[model samples]
Target: MAAMPPMDDELKALQWRAWHRGTREADLMIGGFFDAHREQWGSQERDWFSGLLQEQDVDIMAWAIGAAEPPARFQGPMMQAMQRLDYLKAPK
Candidate 1:
């Protein structure tokens, strides 16, 4: 049998804080992306999402987060937006 990885207080605290930090970072990035772009997508987007608001939001954001590539139809625009965002985020 393989040896199990040892657990410790330091490791647990590190992971707990890291998990929250990561959650905060993801919320900031993805939530900001939604606040920044959801309005700009137009009625076409609204209509498309009209029935599936829950999934649509997550799907679009997952694309922006690099969690998964957007489908072909979404690739061009989201990629363009992501590029612009990347530029805006670059150090002066």
Candidate 2:
């Protein structure tokens, strides 16, 4: 298997994934959240967000929108932070 990319590269990849999840709604939700919070994130927070990125966009959206309960592994401060949905904005 190929070696894992460096952490910076991994972060960039995560940013890309956040913005390009195949739908505008998912993109806005995930990508907007990433853009809003990534600067404040430490290594642990980054790791948590990275793990979240591995999940399906549909599931992530469901969790974010409260349409479905997030699993225990995804529950906690980081997910709670996301649950706020503060990153979302009214389109001008």
Candidate 3:
């Protein structure tokens, strides 16, 4: 296969991170979110997701599911969308 462009390469890395979070639940939540929304993301959204991927899976999950409050930086439309949890799909 041909190599991806630089931006595509970066997105692929982010996608890998989202889908390989060391647990089925986290993979589904984070990866599903990525798959559902990535096509529309501009640089700002991608940067937000990149920062989020650096955080612990438990903290990300907790913030997404309302188990704990997110930091001020993470409190915004993106987190709100994650909490909605409408994007997750079961693997076939």
Per-residue lDDT of candidate 3, residues 1-92 (tens digit)? 56533448889999999999999999999999998788778999999999999999999999999999999989899999999999987568
Using TM-score as the yardstick, the better of models 1 and 3 is: 3
| TM-score of each prediction | 0.37, 0.84, 0.88
lDDT-based ranking: 3, 2, 1
Candidate 1's residue-wise lDDT over 1-92, tens digit each? 56545545543433343233235544444444444555355556444333222344456457666788666655565555653555223236
Residue 7 Cα positional deviation in candidate 3, in Å, after optimal superposition: 7.6
Superposed Cα deviation of residue 23, candidate 1 (Å): 2.3
Model 2 residue 79 CA deviation in Å = 1.1
Model 3 ranges with Cα > 4 A deviation: 1-7, 90-92
Judge candidate 3 against the unseen true structure and give its global Cα lDDT, from 0 to 1: 0.92
Better of 2 and 3 by TM-score: 3
lDDT of the structure predicted as candidate 1 = 0.47
Distance from true position, residue 67, model 2, in Å?
Answer: 1.3
Clashing pairs in 3: none
Stretches of model 1 off by over 4 angstroms after superposition: 1-22, 47-62, 65-68, 86-92
Highest lDDT among the candidates is held by which one?
3
